[model samples]
Target: MKQRFLITILVIAMFSGCKKFLNVDPLDSLSGNNFWKTRQDAETYTREVYRLFREGVAIRTGMILVGDLRCAPVAYGAYPPRGDFNLLSSNSIRTLVNTPRIQGDINTYWQVHGAWDVISDWTPIYKVVQAANVLYEKAPDVAEADQSMSAELIRKYQAEAVFMRCLSYFFMIRLFGDVPYYTNAYNDVPLPRTKDVEVAKACIAELEAHRNDLPWTYEDPANRAVRAMRGSAIALEMDLNMWLAGIDEANKKMYYEETDRLGDELTASNAYKLLPMENIAQVFAGRSEEGLFEVPQNVNYGDVLGNIRRTFTGAVLHYPYIQLNQNSTKSELTYTDGYLKKLYPEEANDLRKKYWFDNNIYNEDGTMQCFKFFNLALGENNTTASLSNYFIIFRYAGALLLQAEALANLEEGSQKAEALLNQVRTRAGADLYSAGTDKNLPDAIFYERSKELMGEGHYYYDLVRSRKIYNPDYCYRPISYGNFVQGAWLWPISEKALVNNPHMTLNNYWR
Candidate 1:
């Protein structure tokens, strides 16, 4: 991550306008043309692009929806007394919407408007993509003091950009279903929305083509550390392909083949390894062995403050540590011990239960609040200040599970699937694998995913995708008999987008 600092300094040097370039005014602002003259300039721009990519991946919306932390209550017209974590609440109503739920008006689902508007609005992403495209197109023409090194750097930058673009599109497709797939930034007019399967395939192809260009290991200045080699890319590719396979038949076959190949590559590379259950919290507590890709958040880096995890998971009684001041409601009902017990009743002895939550509070007489995210001592200013915790986007455990699921789906009664499932389950201190025909492979995977990745924003996707396979009726349900029909699966398209893009079509579930 510290290598990124070199790029940051480069951005400041080129864009800072301190240098008198080509007899230009000394104090005049530098344009993109004036900046891309040297290898250093391109390097800095590429770093900034990477920084943005990291930010996009760690967005709270993706985390909240995927992690299964928040759910809509019965009053809002969802089932299980709460909506699944993956499904965003409709924007048609405001009162029921809360943190970890869709913010602003409910109509935003159909219209494409909200705090998330900046992200879904599609400006910043294109900017990053455009910068990457420019670097790739101009790298050959630029004269560098070290020509070979400069060209190699340019290639690396281009690969990173392509990886980021594919990643951005993957998230967009998951959230919006159909989105305009932009290959080149210059083609500005919004392209027609492609089917989700098509988009996933394109994303996979781009990752595969550019995988070799990216460096497997990056040197860290802080501890002279090295992390995220080629294995990381292969693991990510496997994950993306597995997701694509679950969506459709053609994609299923393509993704399965890719996953198998990548899985073998990952196993052969031996660069990444899973963390022990005892070490999982510490792994998350700081930087540990498990994170495949993560967004580094340093308190010194001004933009990286705030207890987003604590704020989302903590109850009001927990107060300041949880950022309770941000919300109006302060009821204890929100934190249901019974609900949690029900979720993990069978594994009470598991150490993860203790690591996953803190049953104590700081206030003189306060009840226990969720302290899974509290890291007071790691911040810069206050002991209770937000710590610089990197959000883990992908982990080796996820890879293991993905491999298991792929095997189960492809080959009937494969022992590999059960063995893989047990590996993760045993680590979590759950029941051992038995030699029996379990028809609920998806459910087993979902349960393991829920336990292993709680509060990480994967629950919603698991729930919705599982519904598509196991129970279709539960996939779409009426929000209320007359008020609105919040389907069993599929989030409503933001209404704000609909208002802006006439060509945008609402999902059948929403209409």
Candidate 2:
């Protein structure tokens, strides 16, 4: 595991000791000594952390794997029975989607991929967290040191950093359950796991306290909708609120209320909205109008590509890799007939059925691939025309669905919930559910979200947070939904994570 940064205090002390005792001007003062003394310094350090967050194994790839593949909600049939097994391997030629070995139990996770380099490398996330923590602690002092820097500007910088830490922790808990909480950059000792509920409470409080510091949109030159802003923080709060509702029974009401408030505030602003149904598929191409925060991946840097595209692209299309290549084992891309029907029911005519998934599901040749993030290689340019698809972290549709779920749970805003659900459904060219006819409005809201956010990586978490993935009989199960709720759907903390910090233990259920 690589350390993201040395302790800021230790570095300053070490450098200060190196200065001349006679007050002679030094020829080699470290640049880091002046780092937190200016606004530019704060901004520059932020870019590094954001870059690290993008490349981190857990963030870059784990989101799609846990949110979509691990407990797949659809039976994506494939030729040669492409395996949907979850492991952390770079062997993309025989990917988990293409060749699922089907080891679903905690005891058997090691048998699938012993090293577990990809998904299990949770350390990378800690790097980003540490960076944010350092920034959060130093920004205020930096502003105080510089006479020209305003306290307001410093607070905004601090708020964004806090949002980053909170965002990373939110996903950490979502993926690994309990995680060791850190605030300073130098906490290298092994720490015990903190209860997720407490962590969530702390994070949400921090976000709410500083929400006013950020703006609704950040289109500044250095960050044009690329970084965390007010809307991004609000969206995160909505997700955390919903997840807390499922985990913390004592505070369930509070969670719902905050969820409703944040959703309402974000919706009322009208800063972002769902695009027309026709452009839904193209939403993943990068800075679309509806995006709250999307991580850009430039093709020139040779990004790892999106898991949605890599896992869902069928062997038929010669995208990314040529059709002739032997690495053509893409089974986890197609959905079973029953799952397709459930996704877009008979009465509902979701345009997403065509825009997101392959329209011709009946084609036996197995050409039905998800078109959202497909990296089409123009045969003439030899990969020159192919571009990286942006990872959509937060969007308007997701925010609206979160609000609709909260309203449904309250059972007081049936009309508002229906309107919220309809905003997404109506855009998708889907038939709207009448408030009078829908008895289980809560389930309907959750289901509509499942369809709208299917391949974009929200379904599995949605099921777990709403306590819907616990039952084997749950209707959302794909054909290979094994060990669905034996462990609350949280992955075991890697052996490496434990070794790095021996005080930490495996997730409660896995232990």
Candidate 3:
């Protein structure tokens, strides 16, 4: 009955005034006096925050465009070597959006319209913040009205609300540098952008207070990693600190220390872990033991969201993963041979190379497709069906690597860093690490992340946070330090943001 009621609220959310208020003005949605009387009401509203976040990312393939493609070494494949991938590879933002849209499959494959809108707009993400704010403000009241809703349960739900809010802000800070920060319920004041460092600090404090309110794991199998847990909060806290350590030089050591300690705590908890490389499919299939937090996508339940063509698999897979009749047998995109060689030398005995790529792994042509985000095809070969996969936001391996990265930034911490880095390498059946003449421990950890997290929408942000976006050795699309200071790395704020707010300004660097 509870599950069905939640579903019913979701259905109503799509059609009723609830949806309108959430989209247009979150403040308006909370005007109701009687809405906060039940545990079910609190729970239903909390789930919408997750749904809104999934929609924001999945609908337009936002993460792939924002996270993976920028500054990365990639080339066009079976499709015509169009300007889109080349532009992204070169960090040519102005030209990429302004160029005439390609006709036919290329246009659809790129989803240029959606990409352009998502890159400029922050509305979708703010919608999530709004919903979360509502829940955070109102969840406490549920305990007063519902005899069955305990204070602990209300606190847990409120913690989930804050988790979603912090997660949304972290994503925005990476993309836009600083964004307008708020937590007051029904806040409608027009505001200017906050400094990214300030936003990070505030979110860190907020999350630290509420992290323990969440459980280590869920009793229900379906809620395992999909719901926020202690592991999820800790993992997010680690990433936010790492981001802070990268940009805020004066306080970087403190940020690094916090990340290292939190990582130790997360691992020591033993609440999450890496699955064997042989069970790689299970890892991507969602709700796995390794998942810290994920945007759920289940094709079996008719709950699949977003365009597959623009997803990581959609951009790379061909033939068997997609229908041959309407799609090319060759992949639409592939990593450059240079990048591939840099990530995986021919001499390295890594099992990931064998498990994740096809025979033409080195091909500059679009023939190479990654099998990391996919499992079994939905139908027989050549069927127009998507493989079962989930949009993983954070997982145990990523957290491990993040911990390794944080340690590497600290003084006299190389040995400890190597230990953390090798944990991932050993799992991949690759030779364990020792700092060598050619590659230092830091670069090894960076490339290990590059190799392990190839298509998961993390590499580009990794480059940005590490200041590697300007280094030609690390980035294929290196911008000069001058441009970086001019906010070249930040996405141009949409004109829509300035419509009602007098304090709003755009990222003039793009202009």
Candidate 4:
């Protein structure tokens, strides 16, 4: 048996202390034989895939800006240094995309702050896919080169690599409708956009085959949810199924049934559980059993580095959590009264209402703050503080709601749906479901998600997938079915995508 060399030198160099190394770009090095030689090399390359995904989403709070901000429950307040809150809240993609940034122009806050990077740039995401592709193609060679690398370990690394690649494509389709998909490690052949449904189907089959290769959980507590696990793979499958069900509506029943079954399997594993309401702070702190997958952040070690203030938490929180001025009492945004009421009615006994809000959820005033992502940091003079919550992508409770949703849409599965829905509701100390003549189980489940996952970046996508975006009864900013069919919901693809690839086209609805 030979030694397993460490990749920590490259990892540390990538993050900091080496500007020249980053400038040269190291992802391409993975394809060379000089790099991928041992089990540690395979492990390190997989970690790089995760790092690329985190960077892609961390840009301008990229995931939240696209996933939660658009048509979210937020309203702009009369505060300095605000993004296009109205544009985001109203789902105005064309105008927002076209907004120009001129010096000294407060109007260009969104552009000046890199809204284009969030809405258009797929480069970082593609980098994730590219790295994953390289890992998947090259990991097997490690077993041949290093006697210590076992076939089982090599398969696990390949499974993790494919998982990240599929996850990246899933995000791309949600944001841009269709995207260029590829799998060969270093191939540079120009490609056209594949139908997102085809992309989803291909990814689902790939993950289904490798799902058992990953473990249900890691023995190391720190690695539990942050690393790829069987739960994460299944959760991603559920999400892909739901997204397909939304687009490929003719066969939605099949998708929903698959989602329902996946949800049951995830629950039956008993590998995760929802934390008590009092421990809600712990839940957001990351690495908890509830966190199925999250982009880890630790302000102390500077893991998030200089991007702390630009996170999703920064947009909705104010003084105490973050101080913009001597009297920074107001958040830059607030939830709308109508939307707040829709989720948590005046008399609703929801614990989230108490734990997640400051002042009032219905308060039209900008002083209202969402405490769900608030993890305070006190800076010099207490003037430079910011929240340190992990960028949560998937959690156990969210999986439960997804299951509830799938079952509600299936034939005669409403009873099972209520049980799953109530599990989350019961954990929150909110009222458990009891059937009523006036009750709508599906809507209730959706509303529960709206309240529970509020600001965690799931709301806007939920609206789009459920076609609640077409219903004024459900969506605060409803889009007509015709407009939706025209791709009005998708962000415009970056013009950069068309520079070298003749087959690339933009989302013309926004144009």
Candidate 5:
């Protein structure tokens, strides 16, 4: 009789365990120990962190929360009952002022109060940063089979992490002036707010250093691994430098110079090109070219979240109405009399007017529904498809406009600026380029930006950089408070972050 040899495989699975598997003392958690060891491990871990980018930190909440749209005219606890949507009303008394809600509400204080509120809940982003930090610091020691390739991969991932960190800080400073800067994710010490000038300088330095390291393409050669590309970094650099230019005098000059240099680079690279005027909507229809970067959304992915404008502007306000079905669920063809009357182009031949807004389109029941935001397939109740379109953070159009703005600010002749502005307007099918006054070069650019980038969130920044008060009726009303400091454009720090971190200080204007 042959002796049968039985090989037993004992697989011990641990969830959220320590960094090391064998040294696990049973009481120690297994989650932290087993992170980012192999290429696959690093990729998987990085994907989870990338999901935050897909979810909305960079685009949806961050940009829309600051720009003009719907307004809340009533106070916080008033009869109308204001929430996030109504926070933009100037007269509203209810103040939940923070970084997230600063532009829209009263008491736009730039302490730690609201600043922290917006970003504190971004636990996933921080986790991604932490993972990336691990890859940055530890990936080299893996004694990888392909040494140079491994180091390059590690640097690419690290560059992404740095991009996200710097991007977050950029917004933080924009919303809430001086914010605590942390290079290491594990640091528990509360950091004092760095000056805006210093913050801009530091972020630009980081971006410039990592620009060459990022890959030009996103599609991974091995197995279709998606990651941030060099184009994304360049787009971010253009935006950061452009924004930084708006602050003070000397830094303004430096940033403008940088913006011109980067903008020229972006144009020359040929990696990104502007989408045609007709196909512009298709860019936002899904994953398309015009988007330098976008948060991915799908019904199956459980990432279908409503955009701020579509939620409030399309649903509650009448500009573009949401059509409803028999099930009481929102439909796509919502119309508003005000929006049509105010924004519609005078020339009937203008294709963009028809492309962007709704007309006399009707529903099955003969009810007139505006197709401005029509997405019947993705109703409110449907978890699979969301009405909220992919929020476009940086687009090729923005790059072109930034280039135009930079040129306008740098050059003496209005002809160059006018020509640059015309490039965008003419593409949009607007006659303003030919007819509009040349004297109002900046205003022309501003109006063109408002119309072209409408509902894409750029108005408030234009207002801030120009130092012009936003027209109340034309735009959203300005909210004010007694303690509110002038030029307190940034949001106050969140009350929570201040309580947690001791070294953090209130912004100068707010203090």
Candidate 6:
């Protein structure tokens, strides 16, 4: 039999129905005098919301299809199995290796199912929002009751919750054009969708409100790399403002100004810097100084998370009979004709391309597999524990590049932007661009961002946001420009997300 649990079986309600969204209501048996009586209660709820970052690899809630995998750089096709012809010929084995890979394949097999749902499933993401709401709302009561709860501790908890909600909404607005904004858990009735622009502004405002409460690092040193910081909030603010500037021309100057301000704030923090080129791989491994924010991954708690680098973006498994002369590893993605040649020219002498990618790593066809995500944590005791690589959500380089983009777009900021761009390029051992090098500063920034932020899940969003998705001259594969212009880039809402919600409406294109 299952344990009944001490206070409530569920920390945050699993939402059995609209009425059961939270386990304890103000008037319920688990509420008021019973709960919010200790700092531990608030901390527990905050921890539950943290699980969202941990769930990055779950097929239902992961970033794979939504952000990176569906982007232009990837060519989804065949991946050879880890055996001789005699072993691979069996029906069961062939089905095992080919079916799952083929189903998700966007090009060759072309049998993508509920494709949008892979990323657009709003249920779990909303649950995170719900948990944050519950914790944030209870912060005041928890402070009043627990004498041991310092003002700073209470503020940190509340700020963490706010960060969670802000990030969740940012993800929602970026992926879906409009989404219902929920602030409290008690409102179970369906809410109407809010404009993405309005939601973005609200997210920025929230981060600004709570940014001061978070420290550069958590008290637990293990959490230093994993936890959110003031830098994280500042980075998100810059990104959202710039996203607004890119998509909406009417407010371009205003958004760009804010983007510039936020970027400047992050740079002035003096808390982060780009990693040394020789140690670029260390950037993705947990808590490097280069990271603004990352999700900690280790052997015990990291297994459930599917690492895109080692699992999805790796090369096909190689064996004696395959004749491909490859190693036995599985990678769901690879580069196509135009990706490498366009951004990273042969003579560019880019250090990152050589450091982070290889032509001969289990791929003998002269194709490439990303080396950026190879796990340094698993150097010796390694198995299939690919999740050991700390998921690098935000880092110093992204912060620097985003700021450079904002500067490039402004009228007088072009020269400063060029210097900023060259800072990153020079560090990477690439040639610096002279003045008037690019057609315009913005395009130059986009090109720079594409090269600098590859495989970090920022490229697709950059293209769509910059309106570059409409330009056929961009990357060659993945979603077509024609379909993207038709609003196909925004995902269709899941049918289940619409159940029993009268006010809910699907994206018009999908409907």
How far is each candidate from the true structure, as Cα RMSD in Å? 7.9, 7.3, 3.4, 4.6, 9.0, 6.2
- For candidate 5, the 10 contiguous residues with the lowest summed lDDT are 2-11
Q: Please report, in order, the local distance difference test score of every candidate based on alpha carbons.
A: 0.51, 0.63, 0.78, 0.76, 0.50, 0.63
For model 1, residues 408-430, the per-residue Cα lDDT tens digits are: 67765357777878888777776
lDDT of 2 by residue, 1-511 (tens): 0122433332334323222211112222123364677776676677766776776632345455446544543443343433333332111211332233345553333223322335555666776776777777677766666776688877888888888888888878887877878666445356788899888888989999987898877665336457777888899898888889988978888888888899889988877777887765456665666787777776565554333234323222333343323445343344443555666665667677666555564443345555555444333254433335566778888888888888877758778888888888888888887967777788788778766766566777776776666544543342223544445366655566554444667755444
Q: Which stretches of candidate 1 lie over 4 Å from their true place?
A: 1-32, 55-120, 139-151, 221-229, 250-254, 285-287, 302-320, 323-339, 346-349, 359-368, 376-386, 436-441, 468-511
Task: Point out where model 2 deviates above 4 Å.
Answer: 1-34, 57-60, 73-81, 86-117, 144-148, 305-332, 362-365, 375-387, 473-488, 500-502, 508-511
Q: How do these models rank on TM-score, best leading?
A: 3, 4, 6, 2, 5, 1
State the lDDT of candidate 4 residue by residue for 1-511, as single tens digits. Answer: 1222234344333333322211223454454556777777787778767877886765434556566778766766536655666777788877766778877777675465545545586766776777687788889888777888888888888889888989899888998887877777655456789899999999999999998889888999888778888999999999999999999999999999999999989989999899998888878888888988888776675644455435666666666666643457777777774777777787978888888876566776777777777653334343332355678878999999998899899878999999999999899999888877537998888888887887777888998988888788777778888999999888787776776567778899876
Which stretches in model 5 have alpha-carbon errors above 4 Å? 1-33, 56-63, 70-84, 91-132, 141-149, 219-226, 305-349, 360-388, 432-437, 470-488, 507-511
In terms of lDDT, the poorest run of 10 residues in model 6 is 83-92
Quick one: how many clashes does candidate 6 have?
3
Question: Ten-residue segment with the worst summed lDDT in candidate 2?
Answer: 20-29
Per lDDT, the best of the predicted structures is: 3
Kindly provide the TM-score of model 2 when superposed on the true structure, using C-alpha atoms: 0.80
Candidate scoring better on lDDT of 2 and 5: 2
| TM-score for each model | 0.72, 0.80, 0.91, 0.91, 0.73, 0.83
TM-score of 3: 0.91
Error of 1 at 173 (Å): 0.3
In terms of TM-score, how similar is model 4 to the real structure? 0.91
lDDT of 4: 0.76
Model 4 spans with C-alpha error above 4 angstroms: 1-32, 59-61, 81-83, 301-305, 376-386
How far does residue 343 in candidate 6 sit from its true spot (Å)? 2.1
Error of 5 at 20 (Å): 26
State the lDDT of candidate 5 residue by residue for 1-511, as single tens digits: 1111100000122112323211112221112343333565445445544654544364334334345432322212211122433444342222434434346444342222223244333333434444444445544444353344466777766787777666666655666666556565334344566787677678778888986787665553321113565666677777777766766665676676777678778767776666676666556654455566655444354333333322322332222233222233332223232433344445434456666544443222123333233343444454224344555656777777776777677765356667767777677776655424446566666666765665555666666655443444434344333333353455544444455455656545544
- What lDDT is obtained when candidate 1 is compared to the true structure? 0.51
Cα error, candidate 5, residue 273 (Å): 1.9
